[model samples]
Target chain A: MVQKYTSMAYASADDLVFGKAKFPVKAGLGLEIGAGYTTPEINYAPRPQAGKSKEKLIKEYERITTDSMQRMVQIGAPSVVLETEHVEQMTNNPSWGGEVAHAQKTIMEEYHDEYGIKCALRHTPGDIREDRDFLKLRGDKYDLLMESFEQIAQNGADLLSIESMGGKEVFDYSILRNDTAGILFGIGVLGSMDMEMIWSDIADIAKKNNVVAAGDTDCAQANTAMFIAGGLLDKNLAHTIAIVARAISAGRSLCAYEAGATGPGKDCGYENTIIKSISGVPIAQEGKSSTCAHSDVMGNLVMQACDLWSNESVEYHGEFGGTSVQCWGESLAYDCSLMNVALKTGKEKGLRDLFTLSDKYRDPQGYVLAYENAYRVGQAIVKDGTDNYLRTKNAAVECCTILDEGIASGKLRLTRFETKALAKVQADLAALPDNSDQFMSDCLTKYKEEVAVFRPENYGL
Target chain B: MLDLKKEDIDGILIRYNVSLEKEMTPDEAAEELYPKDELIYPIAKAIYEGEEDDVIDGLKAAIDAGKNPIALINDALMVGMGVVSQLYDEGIIFLPNVMMSADAMLDGIEYCKDQTDEVPEPKGTVVCHVAEGDVHDIGKNIVAALLRANGFDVVDLGRDCPVDEVIEAVEKEKPILVTGTALMTTTMYAFKEVNDKLLEKGIKVPFACGGGAVNQDFVSQYELGVYGEEAADAPKIAEFILASGDGIEKLREEFHKH
Candidate 1:
């Protein structure tokens, strides 16, 4: 039987019902979605080939765009948000005024008519370096943004998620505060923020305008508090929670994404995860995506992500040969790490209930690990290798060692990363009589032995 | 065949840089342990690998057979550490193997201490640790293991060491070199405190810093700092101090410019 969305999906008040736990009770899982739009890095593939004809170019664009959109949808995602671009030179240099209008009209018609889904036209408010660039607030350049939003809204655009600022600035700028009000039907904040305030404001603004309100932050548990605080609509909260929860739990947020940029994806995709996850409310983790080169690599990644879901409804992001896994994994780790936070915050049950709902509707394999048609297997492995291996193996090894010793020593059984930490302390105490080197050797041996128990029977012939 | 006991292999790794294929016989293992020409190594790995049928008899027999203990220690054990160090840098060896090799090397060192008439002074005292908030200490542990294998006195602070404790140890011990390994951006900042405080008090202990989150740019940017590119680089850094007559400034001048 098809399952209905959890009551948490519809419940919102001072007494928030987050998964299994009721509010006015204790802390529950916190989740935020909103990563600002980022200009595609200059180096990604499918970028403009140096020498290509209009026909070839159009074909490539269509192939990439269609595949990406379909991948987004298959992931149970409601929409694919693209970096805003103009019909710079569409087939035959048609009139700028006429072409953009025509493009918007065609896009709206195709989204609802052909795909039975919605599309969002996003662009920089200004030159990406400039603040308020996308809102059409800065000089004449803002005209492009204003016109695009107007044309899309008037035509068939379902919702608009504007990149308010970089993750840090989103809280400070309060982009949803005033200036852009009434100019658009709905608004979403992309990037990091003070979650508690952001959620209250989103709720207030969304209610005032009679439109949906949403915002998202990076993988930090503090950031997720916004969602728990009634920061976004049900649809937005659900989607954000699932994506953030799964990413953090799997330890995907530790790897670096953008080259030369710090804090992993100080460049792009990181912020996009936040924004889209928040804006696509009630969708839960459906907004997350992972870009890799093949299916198997991303498949393993999706499985790992599924393991991270506190709410049985898993949230993951998959793309084939699209972006860097280093960036993707870092964000994923960040999401996975937040799961414990969700549990402690009293939302583990609600999140788990949502997972149950999600699992029934989708098979584990059906979960989206690729975007479009191309599948990336090996591409993501190395990307996930460095940071992912460091964190995951550390946890896994620690866990096994702790469990094995606890059993041998006749201690009560425990499961969870915390058990590993606790078991380590106990093991250390037990091994204190040995010299440091011997102790370390014993610890490592015990750890390996314990970990071997969890390993598959056929591992490493 | 590449099959071999992990710990026995661990010994050969300490005494010689060579590794055995799985499942080799005692004779074959001995042959693999011996040299072909010019006798660069003075002892065979067989003696070290041999199991004791009678502990007292085995020791007496080996001595009567004129197997030099120091020669065995230098050839089989130190050589193994050198090989392990190289393998570690090449990523062919991991922390556990390096550790096992270090342990074997230490066993040889302890044996030498017991057998010799006069004990040798340790190469130098070096302080090492992973900075606070940095839980990944495998790198630091590897550095300490290698340093110990090479005869330096290593005071390992283990993982998540605070800056004040590190500074107090430096002030009291005045170790020729104090190293901090941090694999997280958040934790790497503490190294700067250690570096700054040392320079502030006019102390000149060369601070060797390196790990995943740390880049050469960040290390060189700090005062009295030398960037250790790999765990193996620790011994090389220690060598500079021993050669420089405990002059940390001279060591830093030669190495920190990079």
Candidate 2:
């Protein structure tokens, strides 16, 4: 059905690149970061905490925002969206308006001062009200929420992003097409975003909104979106493809901003650029081993996910679907130094494996098919290792150990969970050639040895 | 590829068919269509196609002819269902087709069960649900359908289920594997709650969590929690749980081993 629109979205999507937004696009080897956070304290808040005085809340945000912004600069982010300052509201309670406003001001001041980086602030969806009709009726609170974005925009913020519970609300708001100046809306389909409700209107909303919509990192949500978009597969294939589509669709400039939650000890989402690439359409991922153990895992994930595409294509269509012009094939990597910065022994082994392998295959067009083929072989390894990965105690420890060794050797760099060992690994890996086979092979041998020791047979599968 | 003639429909329908279309009680059809050699593939195909009338008549004819329900289910109905699943997976078919196929398969199976007089062992009950705050259940539904087709007795808790309900199911059913799915961060933590509650209760069921908001790393962090990377991972987890012989700690330990 042809969709009717309600409002104009003023944000210009012309500046928005598909894959990696923050990182410059390098024809040879591009790197972009996945920036943002999902602080659980906000989600698992104290009941009274939700109603914390704006002054108190803004103070807390001030501390968090300062750190987050500083980290963005340190990590080499070209542009950063100031994390949303507004919290979901509870009805008939003390409002968080005061704190949210203060946080907004703090972010604005910092962004204006730090002109080197592009800044965007997300609009809060406001408190959960059972009155579904409130927004339609232009209820006072709903009007206030819309006015909040205007206030943010008028206050000299570079971009205004509207966040809701999911896409359905966005569709209902008719903002995707609003395309009004300085205003944009991004939808998150992952985690608690109503898939069925949102899906019914998403494509139309996207078309009407004409605002670029962000796909999620959640495998199921992405898969559901893909299926609704015309791809079909069993549950397993769906999950795998969801990651690929979400990443690939994002393209090179904004690969890191592809929506997913990241925080300490959360696995529902992955952090590596390689997993992001392989899981979705191919694109270059930036940063070093932030959420992964070694560069090899990025290569491993990319190759494997690519293999799923290639193999599935051949099985059904009898020919590998080339990386179409629409799909730019690039290697993705992540920070894998989170596991350890302390244990000094296996650091070099992990670093060498990642740098050497990824460096050799960094060419986007040259080795696309080959990468996919190698990934198919890796799938077997993943399958075989499934039993080991499932182990609660020994397996978790072993995986952590692998992460630690890579970080120490300078091969893996986990941004969120930093360790001293990672710096050493990064320094070592930086010295290696971009494509040295001999160096890679030596690294692999050492990795095998480390795996033998750190992750003994009994420890894994 | 085997082309059985339309006339062969007599044989295929003799043992299985949807009773809604055939105007026969499951028991009546079972007694009359027993040992029917003719009613195999066609009846199964009819069920897969959701040919309600044809399926009912076919079951009765097959049963009257003395065909075993298990054989008909395995050879025809199951075969057709497999084809439907493959088609659905390949995008050749869709969700409605699968639901229709499942409905047809179940109708014939019911007749057979009625005839057998012995209850089929619930092939390892599994507790499955979407996590709290996560309202999307389409993915979960697909998993449920596939699991049921693969011979699992699924204790489906439906969409947007609370963590407590999931824990209660684990406590009540003692399923070999309990799974939680969340499509959003809003509800993914419900998995953690289930994991914590089960651990608290000393029930060591393998907890598999998957969906858009779920990640293997997060699942690995929790005790007794095995992050299901996909919906298909559920059956594999169930297999592991059953093989462990109710070894909950072993299951937890095994999940973390990766």
Candidate 2 off by > 4 Å: A1-64, A71-79, A83-101, A114-118, A124-223, A227-461, B1-37, B45-57, B67-104, B107-119, B248-258
TM-score of 1: 0.36
Among the numbered candidates, top TM-score falls to 2
TM-score of chain A of 2: 0.32
On residues B1-258, what C-alpha lDDT tens digit does candidate 1 reach at each position? Answer: 012233343332221111221244323443544544223232223222322222223333444667555554554555545555554454332343445446555655566557656555455789998886454554676688779867688998776787888888888877888999975444577788888888888887888998754767677777677888667678888987777665645655666545
Candidates' TM-scores? Answer: 0.36, 0.45
Candidate 1: stretches off by over 4 Å: A1-461, B1-76, B86-96, B115-117, B243-258
lDDT of residue A234 for candidate 2 = 25
Per-residue error at A111 for model 1, in Å?
A: 25
For model 2, residues A381-450, the per-residue Cα lDDT tens digits are: 2222212111111211222244444335442322221222223323433444333234334433543442
Summarize candidate 2's per-residue lDDT along B163-192 as a digit string, tens digits: 788888888997877778775443565677
After TM-score superposition, the amount by which residue A43's alpha carbon in candidate 1 deviates from its true location, in angstroms, is 21
